[model samples]
Each structure stands twice: as C-alpha cells, then as structure tokens.
Target chain A: MILTDLRGRYQFGFGRFMERDYDDIPGTYPLDSRTYRKGYHVNMFLMSLNDAECRDKFAEDEQAYLDTFRMTEDQKSAVLDRRFLDLLKLGANVYYAFKLISFDRQPPQVMYGQMAEPRLTFDEFQQMMIDGGRPIDGNRSVEEWKDG
Target chain B: MAKLIAGMGTSHVPGLGAAMDNGKTQEPYWKQLFEGLEPLRAWHRANTPDVNIIVYNDHATEFSLDSYSTFTVGVGENFEPADEGWGPRQVPSMSGYPDLAWHIVESAMAEEFDLAVHASMDLDHGFTVPLSIAYGQPKEWPAAVVPVCVNVIQHPLPTALRCYKLGQAIGRAVASFPEQINVGIWGTGGLSHQLGGERVGVVNPEFDQKFLDNLSRDPLANTRISHTEFMREAGCEGVEMIMWNVMRGALEDDVDEVFRLYHIPVSATAYGAIILENK
Candidate 1:
C-alpha cells in the first residue's frame, strides 16, 4: 500500500513507546506540505548558499546572517552547529539542506555517516557500500523489533 | 523528419561538476569518475546530435512549493545555469529548441499526458552536471536542448510507468516534427543512494549494475517497481530511476548499450551511466 494510505486515523493503547518508531526507517523524510511550511526560512537561507558573497557573510557572523531569515532558533542553531541531522528533524530536505554541507566544504558522505545511529566511522560507512549495502534485515530497528 | 538517434543516462551529482571545475579529476577521490567519462566525451565529439531532450528535476532552486509541476516542458529559447546554493558551474548557457519542445507538448497532451510548459527555467546542477560530464566546459553547449522537468523531490512522485509512456509519446512527437534533426534524450540523476533520514550514504552497486544490464531489453520490469520497494531495495533517492524510463521509452524497445560506467562514493552516491543507441 502507498504511504498515504496509512494516513487518516489510528487507535492507541498500552506500551511505553506506543506510536510507531520511525527512527529506524531509512531514507525517508517529511519533505511534504507540512514540513515545507515549517522549514521555508531555513531552506531560503540554504538556497542563498549558492552565492559566494552570501556564504562569506554567513561564515563571518553566523547569528547575524541567520537573523536575516525567519527561521526558528533550532533551525538557526542547526546552521551554526552544522547539525544536519537536527536540521532534517526540523524539516530540511536533503537537496536544499545540502547547501549547508557545501558551505562547510565537506563531502556529504561525512555528514550522513555522522548522523547514523550507532554512529559509523566514515571508513566503516564507505565499507558498507562496498560490501553490497547495509543489510536490510535487523538494521531496520535496534535489537529485536521489525517494522511489522 | 526529426529522428531520435540515441539515449543515455547519467548521474548529475553536483560533486562531479565541482571536480571538473577545480581540476580534481587527477586527485584520488575523483579519478575513477573522470576516467569513466572519457569514452562518453569522445562519443559526443565524433558524432554530435542536433538537440538533446534532457529529462531532469529541479532541487527547490527555481520552483519551490510555490508551484510544483509534475511534468514540465521547456519551450523557451535559452536556459541559464542556476547558482544552486554553491555557485553555478562555469558552463556555457544551454540552447533550447522551441519548435521541437512545443510539438512534444502538443503531442503529449494529445496522448493524454498534460505536460506543464516553462517559458523560462534556470538549469540546475541536475541539468548541467551531465552536460559538463559529456561535453566538457566548452565555449558553448554543442547540442541544443529540450528540457523535460519532473517533480521527484516531493512524495507521491510520478511513477516509472507514466514516465515511460511520456517518452513513447515524445518519440511519436519527434518523428512527426517537420525538420531533419538528430535528437538525443538524456535522463539525469541517481544511480543509488539515500540523502536523507537514517539511511543516508547507503549505496547499492548490485541494484545499480542490474539496472544497467536490464534497461535495454526488460525496461518495463524496472518500471513496474513500487515506490517502497525502491526505497527499501535501492534507497529513497534511488527512486529517481524513473527518469531513465522516460529516456528509455523514447527509443525503440531494442537499444544497443554503447558505453557504461559504474563507480561508488562520488560525493555520497553510486554514480552509474550508460549510452544506448536505438536500433
């Protein structure tokens, strides 16, 4: 079934983490109508990273630069801290969010590797791709939980 | 009569364009990617196509959530390379063919595919990186272009089957055009890798290679793939494979694989490319 089909309503009861743990789901984001609205200012600042002059201004004084946009403190701090993973949580699409990574003059592989829970070393992550890929089984969630 | 001569697919990862710009091809990280492009560069030089039908998507640079079109046809006269948050590649402005673009638009509408028309569009790295990869940073882009834009970033992206059908309609449109032009359809983006969420840096060479193998004869099998399956088996961004179907379906079902390259860790993705000449 399409993901949209899983929308509408759901009933809940009982255990501690009752809601689905979406953390284990790989390569998905809320880059749709809702997230777009939330992250517009953050994304706008990111888009400005295309300009060399803008990047210079941004790196010079991070707070004053980000103040130009209407982003939340979290979004502004993410830009300052280079918290790419946190930025995603606050609704940054990777395509637009990558401008931040570019601003730092770092390859995206570094950020994604750092974001991996259980946090992989850059070498360990690169090795994963070469060894086919991260195994689909068990890796979906920590310990014994499957998506089902 | 206008004819579709060949079709090719390339990853338009911005890192490749940067590598070419900074002369980092000789460096260890980019050496293999530059080496892979050598044959493709020669192929374009030896024989040039009059125009290229570039199938690519914008990365929130030109079209934001303000107005998103699922399928856009550029019927403009010229396209400027956009500064996609990290400066534009120093490539020449791309030439566009309005006559051919409009004809395809009309034909696609006639075939029940309502393609949005773009009078002005800025070509992002998704559109220009492939140009830099194959043509080098020439004074002017040798081949004229017809840009076919798709919406891939947002969820509920257009499916592979729809893209393939659009390519077939485009093929019929090209054949009916009243000009003696040799055209190439280029699909750009994503061999396999996830850029967002927990699965970032996940690259699958197996899925990438098999796709290269099966694209010539068994394309519909690739098109029949579900979105979640691609997310699971290939990764989220790997769903960009639908763009290749648009290129493949434009050619005849039988295509000869001319040149192929598959390399890993180009920035963060598995970059795969292949040149297929229609038989």
Candidate 2:
C-alpha cells in the first residue's frame, strides 16, 4: 500500500505539473500537495532560520523557539531530534530542513549522511560520494530493489 | 540592438559558494572541481557580457514557502545576497539591469507568458554561485544581471517544455531590445544529487553526462523528459535541470559548445558545467 501511494504520485501527470502519487519510486520524497499541506508549519518554522535574530533565538532556546510555531508534535519532535528523514515524512521539505542544518553551521553532507539508507556517518557519506556516488542500479524503484 | 552571445549551464551547489568565500578552492577536497572550472573562467574573461540573465531557483531563503511565485524576474536596481542561515556570503551585490529586465518582462507578457515581477529579491547561492564560478571573486561583477527565478521547491513546478518556451520568449525579448549590448543567459543548479529521503548520496554521472549532450544537441527531447524520469534516473533534485532548458531555449538551435566539465560528488552533487554560444 505504501509502495502504491509512492508510485501513484508519478502516474497521472499529463506532461505537466499534475498531482500524482509517486511513493513507489522508493527513497524519494517529492513535495506534492499532500506533503506541502501537511508540512507547511514545520517548513515555515525552518524558513525562519534565514533571519539572524531568529537564529540567535533558536540557538538560545531550541525548544522554546520551536514551540512558538504551530507545528505538529511529530514535526517538532522530528526537528528537535534532527531526524531528517522523519521530518521529511512529517512533511518537511529538505530545502527548508536545510535551514536548520545551516543554522547549526553543519555542512549539508551531515544531513545527507543522516538521511542515507542504512544511515552513514559523515565520513562514510563523504567516502561514498568520492567513490562515484551511490549507484542508481537496483535503486530506481521499490520493486527493482525487491527483485534484486 | 543587444545580441544574445552565449548561454551557460552549471551546478550552483551552495558548498561551492562556501568554498569560494572561505578561500578553500585550492583545498584538496575542492581542488579538482576548481581546476576543471579554469577553462570556463578564461572563457568568461574573454567574452564577458554587458548583462547576464541568470535563471535559477530560490531555496526558501529569499522567499518563504508562505507564498512562493512560480516564475519571477527581478527589476530592482541592485539585489543583496541572501542570508541562508549562515550569514550571507561576503559577495558584492549584483547590479540589476532594469531596462533590459523590464523589456523582457513586457515582451514575455506580450507573448502570453505570465511572469511575476519583483522589485526586490535577495539573490541566493543559486544566483551567486554561478557568477563566482565564472568570474571568481571580483570586486563587482562585470555584467549587470536580470534574475529569472523558477519554482522547483513546491510541487506543480512548471514543465520542461513550458520553461523552454519561456526561454524562447526571453530570447526574442532580449534580441528586440534597442541597446547595443552583449547579453549572456545562464541556467544554474542540478546534475543529480538527491539530498532527502534514503537516497542522499545519489549522483548519476551517466545521466548527468547524457543530459549535457542532449541539452547541447537535442534539447527538444529534453523538453519531453518527464519529472518521473528525472526522479527515477537522476535523483529527485535532478529535476532542477529543467531550468537549463530555459538557457538552451534562449539560444539558437545550433550552438558552439566551447567548454564542458563534469565532476562527481562536490559535497553530494555531480558538478556539471558547460558554455554554449549561439552559432
């Protein structure tokens, strides 16, 4: 069923930007209308990090700063935990979630590492990237990986 | 009349911008990438345009998700570099070419392409990194700019074909301008590197190289590459390559491909750069 939902997102576009279910693509979280609607508040909170004053406040009291936004409990927890993939599942766009990463002065690779399948440490992620990146073979779709 | 002399396509990875600002271009990690770009820098020195039309996407830095516009052009006289969490990079503010910008906007609208015009836009890495790569750390950029922002963040992004057609309209708009000026259009970002979900370190060199070839030789075919294929083959973020179509569409059908560079995993992206001039 989850696979169907992912696959459906990409199924219905008429050579234009129509809403389609694309969950079957596996390992990709496209910011469709559904995710956009769900993750709006969390993303808004993330976007706030663009301002210096907001960054100072966020750095001063992380929880209190996050509490000001009307994000869901899952969104808040995911953000607080630095659970990047969970934040995405909770509707946080990676670009917005990146604001939080940027605020912490961590390179984006840290978040990329955390978001990797089987999760990589920063060093492992860098090494994988150096080794010509994760191969697209067997990684295209859920069914491809399953069959492989 | 102003002539469209060249078009460029390159990845505008934020890390590349950071590398330039921090004087880390020669660091072991970034040395190869910088070395690959020397030819491009030399090319820029030889044929610097009077004005550059930069087509890029804002990454929720300058504009929040609260209200994101699909297609926007900057008409402001100057644009400040946006502070994307880390303090804004210490780069010179870009001078906006209002006359040319307004001309393109009016001409595009007249041609039935609806475009949002912003008098104020904080230029992000998507806008600045390309300049840095081409011109290095200049006190002020040699060329004035017209920023064309595309929506790649939210869903319902403008299709590849739509972006291409818009570029053609912009090309007509630029050519019709009465000033004797040289103009360069650049499409920045992408070359496959997914940053989200379980596919973080993905970079398809095969797809990235082929994309460059098709973009140079068979761009109309690229206009038909669906969003699904971009995600499935090039990674989700690879969809950003649609903006490159805008640069291609603005140039003549047959272009002289002068310089091309393809490198893997600058941070997480397969950095691809090309300079094409209309033949």
Candidate 3:
C-alpha cells in the first residue's frame, strides 16, 4: 500500500484542534533560524539515504556525511538522536522527520497528542497500504486498530 | 478606454507541459484532452490580447518553505523559468512589462494591499504552464506578461477573500494605467487534484465542477472554501485554485464562458481550463 495507490479512493480528515491549538501559542516554542537550518539538513540527509549507494557512503563516514550541510547545534542533536535513527531505519522519509522536529518545538505531550489521529485515516489510504502489501501495523496505534 | 479583453483561468499543473513536451499527451487517453484547447487557440488569435496579468502560485520553487510571503509581484523586466528537478521546460524565457507590473504594484499599495515586489524572480509551473498553454512556444510570447506568484504552498496562505480583494486592486490598477492596452487576467492552477505526501493524485471532479460553476456566478461563494478543506478534497497542491478567484473577482459577474476543458489522471493532477469574456 504505497501512498500513491490511495489516490481517489478515500476522503481523509484531521482534527481541526491540532492546527488551532498550535496557532494559539505562536512563537512560544518557535524554532530559531538555527534549528530550522538543521531541520533542512536532516531533510537533505534523509533524501540522500534513499539510495543504497548514498547509504553506503553515509555508513563509511557518518561525521563527514553530516559536515556536507550547514546545520545548527539543536538540529544536529535531533538528527543524531538514537531514537530518530531508529525511525529512519524503519523507512521514515526526511519530510516526516522534518515534521517531527517541527512538532518537537512544542511540548512532547503536544507532539504525541496530535498523533492520536492516524497519519492516514482514509479508507483509500488503508487500501493503498494493503495493496502494496506493506505492513501498516507498525504505524498503527492501539486506539486506531482497536476495532480490528 | 482600456478594456478587460479576456479573463482566463487554468490549472497550472506542472506536468501538463512536460507531458506534452515528452509526447505523453499523444497517448490516446491524453490526446483528446490536449486537443480540447483548440477552441482556445482560435479564440486567442481572434482577440490577440496585448498583455496578460497572470495570477498563479509558487511551489516552494522561487520561495522556500522556511519563509513565505502571502503575495508577491514581479516587477522585473524578465523572469527565468525555475529548475524544478526535471530541468527548465524547453521554452523561451519570459519578458515582463515592468512599467505595467510596477503600476499594478503601486496601485495595490495605494489600495492598502501590501505586496512584495521582486526585481529578479524565477517562475515555477504556476506561471509557466498557463503561459505555455495560452501562447504556445512562440519565438517570443505574443504579449508582455506580468507574473503575480502567490504563496499557497506554505501554511497560513492568504484567505480567499484577501485574494479576491487583491484581484479588485489589480483590476483598478490595470484600469488606471494611462496607456491604452488590451489586457487579460489569467488565473492558473487547480480544478481539484492534490500532489503531496500520503495524499498524492487525489481528484474531486464533483467539487471541481461545482467550483467552476459558482466561480462564474458568485465568486464570493468560493471564499467559503477553507484551506484545510481544500487540501483535504483537492489534495495539498489543489489549494492553488484560490488564484482563480482573483481572475473571477476582476471580471464582471455575468461573464460568458468562451472556453472550458478538463482532464483527469495526468500524472497526479487534474487539468482544467476556462476562458471568460466580459459582457
């Protein structure tokens, strides 16, 4: 079930509260320019890792791998975080990680709170994942899969 | 008196021209759709507008996601086509009418619409697709173009009402110009299809048709469409359709639909075109 296969199959909806809540506290935890740059670097790094050749290049010299981009201290920390690396190994894309870092700017509870809704809630999304024969269980939540 | 000769609205789908350029449009399914523009071709030749004020969106190509502006006006004499990974389209570079563009900018400012003006700017699919479709690959485009690239990709984009207001300002600006010239306002992008993460290639034909219908009669009805709802139904990129309201607002309520066409499933986008003539 690749994301592409879900096209035109289902209607997806997100809780409006997520954006409303985020807007209410503007700049309370805004990412400084430094953190934003690092986030972009992380994005580029993830893009690079998409290919086996690039992954092998990264494995050979991880430090040099990071040096190629201009990243800030906090961005570097977030990218180098062991937890994030685990997510990367599981096939999360750079855009996803950048979103996670953006969420990180808020409190951890707020970050996780928004995930109450599945990333792909539409039936079309589920059908695509199923057709692709990709495991959706890993991304599913106890609340989301409880009916099944 | 200078007149609003034509009102054009089109989907600025990045892949449309690329599809045609690469001979994808020759495929049976696409050929019929591409040929539908023949009527517009005939119409354009007959009217032969001297200038077009094109309103479109920038897909994080000229402007980054890091910082976004609600509205930007190109006052530069020339604009370079953006390199959107697939490389620039094989088309002649576009020259801008700075005098006209700057006049619009100044007029917009006078109307209290704070617009960002750029001396040197690169245009993405938003501007290029409509131009390519309307004028074709001419030795040079038939008329001078003033590119108005709206920031619809980033979060917190301008509201539909604001965009409509900007159109009024643009209309006023174009009318105030001392030089008499036949001008067209071309609005591009979206008849519903989204291209983005997770929800790529979504199309809502029903909504799209209804939108085009309402747009012709009551453009203000379009303002009721929320950003999230647009992203949800039309797909993330489909939100770019807001630019069409600019064209609609600038035109008289009772406009004749001179031309209309729609094509679906074109590399993850729905392609559409509409030409409205003022009564």
Candidate 4:
C-alpha cells in the first residue's frame, strides 16, 4: 500500500508539498523544509566539527562523538563509512556534510566524485568538469527526457 | 552622505581560498583562473572604496542548522576567519565598520526589511574567498567591511525578488549614511555548479552567461527567475545566483561594466566575476 501510494504521487503528482516534491527534476535535491527538519540532528553533528574541541573529540573517537547526537543508525553508519551519497539520502545538508569531508582531509572534488552516478575518481570527475560539466540537455528535468 | 560607488559579484568557491592559501594560484591547474582575476585586482587597486558591503552566505560555519537566520547583517568591529572543520586559513583578521553597519541595518529595518543584526560573527570562505580574489592576501585588508550574510544553505531561502529588494534597501541605506565615504557592494556566489547528489558536477555555461549578461542588460530578468528554474538549468547550488541580484539591484539601472570573467571547473564551480561602477 505504501509503495503504491509513493508511486501514485510520482505518477500523478499527488503527494507534492513544496517545490522539492516535484520528482520531475533529475538528479537534484533541494534541502527543502522537510529535509531540513529530518537532517537537523545530523547537520548539527556535522556542524559541531567547526569547533576545535569537537574536531579533536570526533577524530579521537568517531562513534562516541556521533553518539552525542540523536541520529539514526543509518546516518551514523553513513558517516562512519564515508558514504556521502547515502548521507544525502538520509538528509544531510551538503554544506553541513562538508565539515565531515574536511575532517577526512579531502577536497570537495573527492566527495563530488563519489556522489556522481557512476562514482568517479577525483581525477575522472575533474576531467569531466573541464570537458564541460554534465551537459544540461537531458539533465535539466526528468520530464523533458520523457517528452523527448 | 556616503556614496555607493560600485557593485560587484563573484563566485566565492572555497577552493579558490585553498589555492591562494597554499600558494597554488600560479600552478598550471589554477593559473588561468587566477590570471583572469588580474583585471579585477587592478580595478580595486585603482579605485579603492572606503567600505565594502559584501553579500555572502554562511555554509554552516558560524551559524548552526538548529536555528539558522534568513538574513544577518554583521555590525561588529572585528571578525576572525572561521575554522571550517579544518584549522582557520592563515589570513589576516578583518576590520568591520559598526558605524556604517548599524546605519545599514537601521535603514533597512526602516524600509521594512527584517534583517537580523549580528554584533559579532566569524568570516567564512564564502565571505573571504572573494576578498582574496580581488585584493590578494593583504596583511591588513584594504577597506573596512560590513558582511550581509544570507542563508542559502537551508531550503526555502529568500526568493530572488526578495533578495533584490533587500539589496535595493541596502543601497538606499548606504546612500543615507552621514559620512562622505565611498562604498562598494559585493554579492558573492554562483555561476552554475551543484555540489551534491548524482548531478554533482553540473555546469551550464549558457545559463551562467545569460545570467551575467542579464545582470546589466536586463537586471529584472534575473529577479523574475524562480529558484526551481535556477536549479533546473544551473544545478541545485546554482540557486545561489540570486545573491548576484542583490548586487545588481544595489546599482543604478545603467552602470559601467568594468570587468567580467568566466571559467569552468573552479573545483566543481563555474567561476564568474563582474565589476560594475555606478555612474
């Protein structure tokens, strides 16, 4: 029943709440109000890394630090595994999640590379960007692709 | 009365700050982008403004996600660089103009723009990288600064029309100040590039160029663009282009476009910059 409802919303645009509910946009996630509420604790945990003390504690013991926040087990595991895309799925704001990337001593390109559809290496992602970032032709909207 | 002399916009990508801090600006990968900044650097050197009101967004550095503000005007006398997970960048502290800042806040409030007045706030890459790009690494920043931070990170950010109106209010605020100082308004961020999701590395040059062109030729064109449209064409983060409308709205409808530059892949960003002087 839940799956049917979800598919119904996608097909008929019934469950739409805000602009973000429009599934017609391809490969885009706007940190909408719902996502903001859901990601609050996780983002708070990530935002805490801004402090030197929090950074030290988090570096010393990742699990213990993550425990300070009331995050879902999946969110915690995503952070632990450096699964950036999964963290996004679990409602991690990209700006907040960037603190985690910095803690790992990686440039943003590395994280962006990991988030790509096929999962590119940093070099591959950099090359793709130089060659002119993912073309806007078929990428703009999922609806446009269907129309084509 | 204080005069609004110039309005400018640029991408405040953190990687540009990283390159400058690590002395990589001249390296092959960074050389062209840095070289493109020479004209803007020269423009600043030739015509220095007494104060710079910079419009930038905090990326979860000083403000946490718990209770983020929609708009914040920095009214402090001094600001330190924020430590964004990593240690703070080795940059000199900045001087803030409380007198001018408070005036702007008051005037804006009088104009019915409900801006959160902040007495103290740390400067992040979003605020400082543009400074680095324009002024280089000065031991002491050349001009006093007043930071106007918008919350672009959270969803349901201020609409393009709203931000533009805020800029118009700020422009009036700066003009009403008692001092005879010259002021520069800068809106930093965006030229198409998403930082997250499977569509992370998207960059639409056509969309970005149209944005740059419309900023002067058809300033209201940008004000009419919806956030959804920005996301569709420019990428999710491309919605940041709305900030540039603030700079454009602050300027006279007709102004001199002093310098403009655009480049691709500034660390997953389509780097764009413009300097416009009020006639």
Cand. 3 TM to true fold: 0.72
Candidate that beats the other on lDDT, 1 or 2, i.e. the better one: 2
Query: Candidate 1: lDDT of B219?
Result: 85
TM-score of each: 0.87, 0.95, 0.72, 0.95
Kindly report which residue stretches of model 2 are placed more than 4 angstroms away from their true locations once superposed.
A1-21
Candidate 1 regions exceeding 4 Å error are A1-24, A51-61, A120-148
Chain A TM-scores in order? 0.73, 0.84, 0.35, 0.83
**lDDT of residue A44 for candidate 2:** 90
Clashing pairs in 2: A6-A22, A6-A23, A6-A24, A7-A23, A7-A24, A8-A21, A9-A20, A9-A21, A9-A22, A10-A21
Q: Report the C-alpha lDDT of model 3 over B1-279, residue by residue, as the tens digit.
A: 456877899887655777666767777646776788888878887887777889987653556534557788888888888654335677778888898899888989988999998888778777888887876667788887898888775556788878888888888887888888889999888877533232333467767887888787778899888875665556546678899988887787688887888766454456778999989
- Per-residue error for B123 in candidate 4, Å, reads 1.1
Kindly list the per-residue Cα lDDT of model 2 for residues B87-148, writing each as its tens digit: 88899999999999999999999999989999988988999999999999999999999999
DockQ for every model comes to 0.39, 0.67, 0.05, 0.68
lDDT of 1 at B171: 90
DockQ for model 1 equals 0.39
Best by lDDT: 2
- Superposed model 3: Cα runs more than 4 Å off: A1-18, A21-39, A42-66, A70-148
Q: After superposition, how far is residue B180 of candidate 4 from its true place, in Å?
A: 0.9
DockQ of candidate 4 is 0.68
Q: For each candidate, C-alpha RMSD in Å?
A: 5.1, 4.5, 11.7, 3.6
